[model samples]
Target: MIEVKDVWKKYKIYQDKPVSFKERFLYKRKGVFQEKWVLQGISLSIEKGKMIGLIGRNGSGKSTLLKMMTKILQPDKGELKIIGRVSSLLELGAGFHMDFTGRENIFMNASLFGLSRKEINSKLQEIIRFAELDTFIDNPVRTYSSGMFMRLAFSIAIHVEPDILLIDEILAVGDNAFQKKCISKIEEFKEKGKTIVFVSHDNGIMERLCDELYWIHESKLVKKGKPEEVIRDYLDFLSGSEEQRLKNEVMQQENQQTSQIEVTEQNEEVNKKENKRWGNGAVEITNIAIRNPDNENKFIFTREQRLEVELTYKTTNLKVERPVFGVGIFKMDGTNCYGTNTYIDKVELEISEHGKVRYCIESLNLVQGDYYVDVACHHEDGTPYDYITKAANFSVHSKENDQGIAFLPHKWFFEKGGES
Candidate 1:
């Protein structure tokens, strides 16, 4: 469990190089520097046994907040209260000594995490096996590759058996198989009710493992909610440059006199009347609608029912030819169920003049669950013309006797004597 209230961290950036030693000796002062608040007034509370994800663009203060929670760095203002022992993998070989052998660094990191000699001795063989460092464990850690060092570091950190685990992007260093092993170990800890604070750019993994998510932007906590909503927002942010978004937000804040917000109680009611674009692009998609054979837009459906997607788009370019339309269905973990492009099918369409194009997909076989649709338009040679990563997202509800991400509508019969 962790609680942060009104937390702020300020860092000093040197503005200019200090003068020569003679000037400094005479001036008796340090170089000129300006303070930049990396994190400002960030507050959040985490419940025990909950896995939380911290997400944002680079320099958005995610790592700063993690360090504050782990007590590696103290906040300039506010209080941070963390319950239970915390094991952190903030960086590769965080507490390791380059001069020390791998075995020595293991003992050092273990002791730093409060593991006794007897306890580390008990798990040493298992740790070695997990790290797969066999004979190389005796070599100096400076000689190890980045991946090997990360593997050993993670192996020791997790073996500490802390109540709280703090992880940054260190998982990126491990190979896929080792990362899988690490995820399984994290799942094991989650089953036992340990707290985890994970920070990553991999939205797929975050959505799969995080119980909740926090989105940090412009030195502040912007949104905290269910993994799906938070991840969606984060993805939208990714579609744009962070610097431009921050600048726009600041300008809007400064000129708040003309800004307006329309509030409505029911989301469905609001969506029925309002058209909201998710991002900026060369082509804009509008009028997205899907329906069944009965033309009903709402309610649950049988797995064997038909599905459709229709949308209209306006192009910004005049000279566009062989414009290919792409559609992708993605799972919650950002995994693609299937994706297709009109270009792949060699459907040639010439758009000599910029105008509107209407696209439709009929009788799509979708299983029972929530799924998102990413639509894009591109040239035949794979150059992006215009597109929305997620044009429309919809949910599929089950009536009964439905399974998997889609319903196959199949009938099976077994013969007793090897006859069909």
Candidate 2:
């Protein structure tokens, strides 16, 4: 959680500032300095347990506001408050000691998170492997390239698992594959209810990852709302001349962002599983999440995209023998759109301990509408070990104007005056 009320920040650029008395006396001239406000009365509140994106152009005070969140820079005026252990990737040169080796820097950087020596020791290997610097772990930081430095830095920041994570366009320093891996890790963070604030120019990330977006313009809090809405307005501010040109370009890119991802409807964690959840004490469904086929976290999907459900569970019994997993998709109006189970698909599973199960639909030919899912872990005899009515709710959209509940593959034909 974070609160910045009427926060103001400024920087002084000194033209001819004299540091010593000797220079001042010899020059007999005063320093000419200019005061510039980087953030002006920037009041905003961020809730806990969701991802956030900060959007703006260069010198638009986006990074300045992010720095204030970490208390690295103080606001010249107004109130600033934050709660949680904070970790930041504000700039590449701020965290590591240039003379220290990569392995040594891991201990030093993570120590700042208030972790004990033993704690740091435990995560050292994981950090190095995630950064893919196993070969160069002992190399000095000064000898490393820019990508290697960022990989280590990003790896350390995430491993510490701070309640709040602040990233300021630092993910741009890696290869395409590594960048994708970094994004997937960030998605896992969001699902774990970590508060993340990212300053990025990647529209795809902003659209697909963030729950809310804040737009800063000219050192002021201009707008804050849903990601798609704010991103649309921010893009228009960029085009200036041909307003819709960039918007059309974004539209071609795809799903819930700017014009590209115009969500017709949305919901916020609507798990109405009160009386809907029931089962025996043998096994309990711990949690469930929705994602794209690429294993990326997602709530909004299109008719053409594949949907994957990740279900995690625990068992009181020594082992859940002959466990059958099932998924039932339904319309918001309580219409049972479809249902299926592992028993029907002839899949086998033996859950001896806590584990996760994955159910995938190669193609959901559903029309534009809001829908809910019911997940179950039961026996082959149609007995329910655990069943949730409204486990997760999501919406589907399409570029075509289809009216039915399911998107049907059809073609139109016309015969005018037997012309054919």
Candidate 3:
């Protein structure tokens, strides 16, 4: 159980970081720094035996609050209390020594959780087996792969038998098998009525796992309620933000380009600076257009509607050979729904200075949600000529109340509950 009342936390942003003593002395007096309040008057209660989630945009203070619950941080204002043996997946390698062997660090890390040496010895083999570092348990952690280190850390933390677990996106550890194993372990813990505070951007996982959800926004608690209700509000807010962002990705140029390719205007240099797009201007994605089969430009469509993506590109390279055109669709949460390239399809290309390429999806089959498109122009050897990411955004709506990323095309063959 936990209680947070009017808790506030702030961080200082220094304009200049001095490297030497003289520079430090010179800048200390001027002190051109600003205080950014990461959390302001946040109050929430985590009831025992409930799995709660904290959802927010990055840097909205979800992790900060989790750390506060673990007592790794103390709020600058207000009262916070927790009554339980706490375990956290935050900063997985914080207490780990690079030079120590994995088996040795297990004892050290577990002891930090107030476990006696004898108690740790009992869980030692279980931790090593779960980490799958059987033969390498005695190897120095510094020599382990990143995934191996994360596996060791996660295995140790979860084995501490804490009454309350505060996890911050550590489920994405190791290979797919390990990740599934970790999720199963967490579910097992849930079955035993252990309190859990989980934070992740994977809406699918959060919806399935959390009993309650809290939305943290702009250093404040925006909403907290059932996972379905709060996540709907959160997704709606994200869609609106994406709408504003799409305006920048979709721009109008002269009608001639629209007639020829229906492309959106872009400043490649600006996009490069923002890391949204980057490539040599030898070949460029002049613009992009998403429309229905009727050639009507639209951003919202149903799962059954045909989605057509047309890309207009120009190449200054007189003989750009073996060109590959690619398009990818991504969920709002950064999950890749689908992607393909002409190279994979073995499509040969012969282009003049400018031309158009179009890819069509007969049925998007995506359940109601916002998705983004990425377009790229590259050589056969994978040298990018023009690679634009999140170049376009669109939404799919459905009458069916099914959850998940996509709607599987199928049918129910039930003959009055009789066997075939």
TM-scores for candidates 1 onward, in order: 0.60, 0.57, 0.69
Please write out the lDDT profile of model 2 over residues 109-225, one tens digit for every residue.
Answer: 999888888999999899999999999999889999889988999999999989999999998988988999999999999889889999898876788899899899888889999
Model 3 C-alpha lDDT per residue in residues 1-420, reported as the tens digit of each score: 989999999988878766778887877855567899999999988888899999999999999999999998999999999998998888757789999999999999999999999999999999999999999999988899878988998898899999999888876656889988888988989998899999998787788899999999989999999988898888778756765565544544343243544233454456778999877767878878898899866687778889999988888787888889999999999999889999898888787798999999998889888899999999889999989888887998543567888898788764566557
Error of 3 at 9 (Å): 0.9
Candidate 1 accuracy as TM-score: 0.60
For candidate 2, the lDDT comes to 0.83
TM-score of 3: 0.69
lDDT of 1 by residue, 22-90 (tens): 766765556678899999999999999999999988899999999988888999999999999999989
Q: What C-alpha lDDT values do all the predictions have? A: 0.76, 0.83, 0.86
**Model 3 alpha-carbon miss at residue 111, Å:** 0.7
lDDT of 2 at 60: 88
Task: Report the C-alpha displacement of residue 167, candidate 3, in angstroms.
Answer: 0.7
Q: Give candidate 3's error at residue 387 in angstroms.
A: 20
Worst 10-residue stretch by lDDT in candidate 1? 259-268
Candidate with the larger lDDT of 1 and 3: 3
